[model samples]
Target chain A: MIGVLLLTIRELRAKKIILGLFGVATLVWVVLALALRLDVIEGSLAGARLFGEEMSGDSDLTDELGEPALGNSLLETFVFGAEMFAAGAAYWVGILLALFATGGLIASMLQQGQVDLLLTKPLSRSKILAGRLLGVSVVMLALLTYLLGAVWLVMSIKTGIWNPRFLLAISVVFVMFMVLYSLISLTSVWTGSTPLSLILTFGLLFASLILAIKPLHEQITQPGRSIVVGLYNILPKFVDVGAHIVPQLVVGETVESWFPFVSSLAFGVVAYALAFRLFQRKDF
Target chain B: MPASAISVKGLSKTYNSAFGKQEVHALRPLDLTVNEGEIFGLLGPNGAGKTTLVKLLLGIVHPTEGSGELFGISIRSPEARKAVGFLPENHRFPEFLTGRETLDLYARMSGTTDMDRANKSEELLERVRLTGSAHRRVKTYSKGMMQRLGIAQALMSNPKLVFLDEPTDGVDPVGRREIRDLLLELKAEGVTLFLNSHLLSEIERVCTRVAILKEGRLVREGTVEELTTQDRIWRLRSTPIPDQSLGDHAHLVSDAQSNGLSEYRLHAADRTALNASLDHLRLAGVEIESVEPLRQSLEELFIDVVEDAST
Candidate 1:
């Protein structure tokens, strides 16, 4: 398995598309770093504004009312807003990109001529499956770390507020992806078709998000509610899990309660275990 | 005293199509044994269960009935493959990896020790005549170069038994001869080889024993000498034939005249009687120029076996 993992890592290193994703990520960070600027003001608390683009020569930092305004620190507000975008918009896009990038890994491995070389080795089917999973996971983890760390660095340099908790978002997004990728891996093993695996996993992802809504949960009958709740519990709570990251950073939310984390971890474990079983029994 | 390298009994395989709409019996119940330190060849027509049988022994496909063993270990277990090396037909490696990296990957996968891995990698690269191209990516290699690299990696572990399917399929004449020499060298080191190829002449040149299959059944199994020998025809060449005194054992032929020399085709019941006739001719002053056994080529034997099975 370790040998497989090492070789898998080598394979990922040569994938031009994955490197292009990393470049896009860095480009996004660079644009964000240059476009947004925030600073401290001694006179009016109302001067708290995140300036986007150039405001020109003589515009007052304060509003026309000339009264002290909403918040004290402009930097905290800016960091808070950026965290939301990172967690919501950027994270979801990253998930979609990952699905597109790694969707064919298992399917490609199972190709007629390719699978024969791998299966003829001295390793068990389960180990080979696990190693491939880990290889993709490590690549994703490296990408997330780079993007999150860049965001942290840019925010700290501009705002002088280095929030250590901001880094947790990397792991949060990675875990969310792991939970989703497990479903993709299982689908790949079951069908050996990349498009089918992608469609099924993405379909279940939207269904899980819709089921988590409180109003929608209320609209269903008692039996339907039970089924919805059961599925929500079993599937990784992607929206909820990603939504919780920003509050913890900007608002000092406690990590004491772990619902989606534990449940999602369990869901990923079960999916991979089932995938391993299927891969072991498969003739290819 | 050599031990059995592979032992199979009643091994079989049957594949079912989606929804059970169709069924294909890829292999029937078959029995086979391959001894250590010998090259065993498997010859078959298309869809004759040759690849299926190799996959079953390698545990790539599960057997539907019966069992097999490799080096006294159960074929169903992964450990049974620990000392085995295989070069699959139409095999593919990761295109991004270089020749050296590909060999390193297989060596590591085979769990070779650190010292032996380094030494063996270099040795194999030289043996396969790819030492100069070891650093080039496989995507840049020609088909013949890729086949050479494939063989190099298959021998990386210095395994006790190696299975090669169409190993020289795309190699040129010179490259094919080099591969044959390499196989013979490995045989000298007591490594067993299981070869499957369509090139009957190549098999005849290197294989110690061969098995021919047709429609999932073993049609013929024997040494090259046993299968191709035409025992009744003893070809004898002499200076001239003044052959009346040689008794009824000699059949003089007018068509045997060539370049003022007499070439006689003698028919005998068996090799012992053939040798007796040759001795009698020697004392009678009919100078013998050459004595040789006339036999069919491996191609002819293979065609005969497969066509006979079809009928």
Candidate 2:
């Protein structure tokens, strides 16, 4: 199992896109660290600058109507906006690049010549796949922590505003990445084609976006509406989680709903279970 | 009696085609036993289930029916493979790893300790003569280099039983000779070797027992000599048989050579008839030099078995 883990790690490390991801992560925080300037006198953010331009410090957190919203000072608002942007970027681009980078691993692992050698090892089938998954998770988690953690640290240090809930975004992004990756694993095991697995994973993700439209339920007829709602309940709610859950977590607000996250977690569990079962029964 | 290294009873595999179109019987129910400290060779044409049998023993694929055991442990259990090493044909190693790294990883996966890994990796590397390229990534390796490295990797565990499939398939003549010598050395160390190879001559030279599979059925199984020996036929090297002794039983295969010895084939019915022919030749003033049973090559026997099965 340790040997398999090391091999998986080595394989992932050899793909330089992952290295480029780390570079992109480092650049994100370094640029943010250098580009933003803040003046904190007596723990109050009296002034802030973007690049070289000055910013007003008295603006209120705005609502959907662009009106000044109630509660939370201007300094807290800046912190919230910055953390939300970082988390959102981590959610979208981070997960996409991660999928592109590691999508083929499961498929490659199942290739005839490769799987033949692996299955002959002294370990059980479950252990082999577990080691491989653990390796991918370890790398992706580290990348997430590096990118999100550094951004959080830079913004917190610059403005003297500490929002610990922003750190939860790391896990949110990581969980979502893993949730989508479960689809990749399942599809790869079923089809043994990396491209096809990746395509279907992205396709599921796209369908989730369409299903997230709550108004579509009323627009459709009886059976179609029932089917839409059924799919919405079944498929991962990437859009809803991104829109509602991730932002709330970033800004240290109470979660409006746990249904999206929970349902996605359930989807991941089923997908991974199916993948392992298929792999075990596969003839290789 | 020698311990059974591998025993299979009624083992078989059937693959269902995609969408339930048709089912392919990959292997017929068969029983086989390989004893300790002997080289067993399996031969067959394409789709003859040679790979299927090896895979079933290694637990790479499950058996559709029947059971198998390795050293008293069922092959269905992971423990059955603890002392087994396999070098699958067209095997792929992690291309990112160096040759030494690949061996160390695979050995560790096989449950070898750190010290044993170090010692075995070094010794096997040197044995396969890959010491210079041991630190180079496997992606840079040539086909023959990969094969040698694979052989070294398979032996890193010092397995009690080893399965080598087409070990010398892509190797040059010299490399093939080296692999054959290495296999012989392993057999001398009291290891059981199960070889699946297309090179019949190699099997004839190294195998103690051979089995030929045709269409997933065991058509023939025996010692190399037993399977190849032509019954009721004997080769006689002697002074030329006189014309009178040249009846149906005894005839000159070739004329006498410079050394005053001729080769004759005697088709005797049995031991009594064979002794009668030798006595008749001797009485006719023909000097008897030697008599030995005639046999076909393993290649010819394998072809006959496969062709006969198809018919």
Candidate 3:
């Protein structure tokens, strides 16, 4: 299992896409740091500028009102807005790109020659599969941490509004990606075709989006409504998760509900269990 | 008593296609044993259960019936492979990894210590004459180089048994000889070798015992000499035989050469009769140049076996 982990780490490093994600993360921080020029008058946000223009909050920051008119709440609100955008982008785009990058790995590992070499080692089938998934998860978690961690630092330092709850979005995004990964793994095992696996995974992904629409749930007639709602309960709640979880965690608002997150997690667990069983019983 | 390296009893496999329709019996019940310090070879046509047997032993595929053991450990247990190494026929190492990295990774997975992996990998690289290309990625290596590197990987664990499938398939003559010598050295160290190859001549040269499989059944198994010997017949190269002494025992197989030697196919009812004919020729003053038992080559025997089974 450790050997499989090393091999996967080397493979991902050679591919260089992870390096691009890190670079994107750094760029986000650099742009945030430069764009928000803050004037600290006696340890208060006396003035703030957005790309060389006066930043306007609910009221105003620097003009017409009085001395040091900008309240810390306005600053917190501004930082919260920036952090939410970063969280949403990292959750949506980052997870999508990560799935694209790793979707083929399980299928490739199951190819005839490679699987023969791996299974012949003194490791059990379960350990080998666990090792492969661990490798992917470790790399993805690191990338997400770097991106979200940098963004959080930049926003907090510039506005002096540090909401540690924002860090929870990192796990939120990471777990969501893993939840989706279980589906890809099952697809890869069932059909050893990488393209077919990715297509099916993406197909379920789009279906989840359609299912997340509340209007679709209401408009459907009785029998069809039961089927669509059942489907919604079964699939990963991708769009609902985007709206409820990461954004709420970023803005320091009360999460709408934990049912969506827990149910999606249950979906992931079942998918992973099915994938492992099939992989263990498969004949190269 | 010598320890048994491998023991199989009534082991079998049947592959079910998608939807569980159209089942193919890849292996019938097989009962065999391979002793330590012997080079055992498996011979067969395509789809003859050779690869299936190897995979079953390695636990890459589950057996449908019966069981096997490696060095007293059940093949069904992953620990049975702790001291086993395998070089597959068409192995593919990740192209991104250099030869050295490939060895270290696989050796680590085989549960070798870091120190052992380092020393054995370096040592086997030099042994296979790939020390110079150790740092080069596998994709850049030639087919012959890949084969040599594979042999090195198989040896990194210092295994008690090694299964080599087509070990010399793509090697040039010199490289083939090197692999042959390496295999001999492993055998000298008391490593049990199970070889599966289409190269009957190589198998003939190296294997102490060979088994021929046809249609998922073991059709033939024996030592090379035992399998190929022609019964009650001998080839004699000698000086001119007196026609009277030749009697009905010898048939002329070649015309007399300038050196005055000719070959004859000598028939005998038994060893006593064979010696009697030779003694008769000696009395007639015909000098014996050489005499030996006649036998078929392994290739000829393999073809006959496969064709006979088909019939």
Candidate 4:
């Protein structure tokens, strides 16, 4: 097992494309966050002018509506700014990172015949697959760490506030990203070609997201809403987890809840086992 | 119990193709044994089931019929593989790894752990003359270097039995000679080598015993001398027309033909009969010039066997 892990690390280290892709992903997230923050700043400043006029004791003197609307304070403005940036950036970042990492990790191994070399080892097939999953997971974590740090730096500069909840939110999103990517990595083993694997993984991810959204539409005007919700809950609804984290971050809430983490982790584990079994039975 | 390193009996394989069910009959219920510490060569042309046989012994492919044992363990058993090393024909390793790392990975896979791994990699790289390019990725290595590295990986565990499938393919003459010397050294160290190659000359130079496969069946087996000795024919060149045209004795078979210099060529079964014919010719007043044995070359032998099997 250790041998497989060591070899996996060695192989991943030798691949420059994986590192380059992760760098591209981090840059994309940072740019998206800055753009979203700029939009939030513009909206908040517009609302602040109305609130300042309403708070001045001159309601009747104002031709504007009664007691101008409550404007966002500096603290509220910054908090809202951070929330907007995190909300827009977190989920997309997770999906792109998951897709890129998962598709490249297994596909590269299969493409380069590294899998054949690994199987020739005395290690059991299961151990080799597991080690590879873990190796990719480690790389995903590193990439997530770098992205999270970048997000924090950008958020602090744009919002002028260092809310620890922003970090917690990024951490939760990163965990969710890891689960999604690990599942995709497991699925990529099914299709031997890189592009095919990537397409299949992304297709499944998109299909699951669509299924998860079906419940919301059904709840507004239709029966069988409970069934739709139940079906959505059973799917690996990463989008729902992202939605949950967004609200939690906006409310500055702690995320020690066991349900979301356990559920995602369980799904990730089962997906990995299934993928490993399939790969083991496959002939190279 | 003469310490046979490899023993196979009744091995067979069949494949189902779109055209029809193609049954190869690779081994055809054949029995073979290689004694320990001998350089045994399995020589044949392409599609002769050599690679299939090697794959079966390595447990990479399952045999449809029959069984074999290596080092007294069933071929299917992993324990047998532990004592065996294999260099598959035209196999590609991960190009991302350096030559040294490739050896290290294979060594680790073979269960050479901790202290031994580093030392073994260093020793093998140096032995294969890749020590200078140890840190260079395998993609940059020439075909000869890759073949050498393949051998080095196969020898990483110092396995008792090494199977090399065309180990010298794509190798330069110098590299080929070096590999031949390496095989000899390994044999000197009491390692049993199962070499499968089409280069009959290489086998003639090194193999003590050989098995030639023709169309997935063992057509010939024995030492080089043993196979070549069958149906021996001698060529005799003589001067004047021999009055004894080799027709008197049934065993003294000869095909006599005259050349421009008053020379006659005679083909006979053996020297004694040829001597008898010569004596008869002398008594009959025919002058004799020279005599020689017509030996069958390995190419002729291989072609004859393969052609005969096909028909």
The DockQ leader among the candidates is 2
Task: List the global CA lDDT of all models.
Answer: 0.82, 0.91, 0.89, 0.69
Per-model TM-score versus the true fold: 0.86, 0.97, 0.94, 0.73
For lDDT, candidate 1 versus 3, the one ahead is 3
TM-score of 4: 0.73
Put down candidate 1 lDDT per residue, A111-228, tens digits, no spaces.
7767787787888887788888889989999998888788878877766767777777777788878888898899998899999999988997888679668687778999988888
Compared with the true structure, what per-residue lDDT tens digits does model 4 show for residues B110-150?
78875887888888888889999999999999989999999
Instruction: Please give the distance, in angstroms, between residue B228's alpha carbon in candidate 1 and its true position after superposition.
Output: 1.7
lDDT of 2 by residue, B106-155 (tens): 89989899999999999999998999999999999999999999999889
| Model 3 DockQ vs. reference | 0.73
Output the lDDT of residue A34, model 4: 44
Best by TM-score: 2
CAPRI docking class of candidate 2: medium
DockQ of each: 0.61, 0.79, 0.73, 0.23
Q: Model 2 residue A40 lDDT?
A: 73
* Top candidate, metric lDDT: 2
Could you tell me the TM-score of chain A in candidate 1? 0.84
Tens-digit lDDT string for candidate 1 (B20-39): 88978899999999999989
Identify the runs in model 4 with alpha carbons over 4 angstroms from their true place.
Answer: A21-91, A101-104, A107-116, A149-191, A215-235, A245-271, B17-31, B232-295
CAPRI-style quality class for the chain A–B interface of candidate 3:
medium
lDDT of 2 at A246: 95
Shift in Å, residue A240, candidate 3 = 1.2
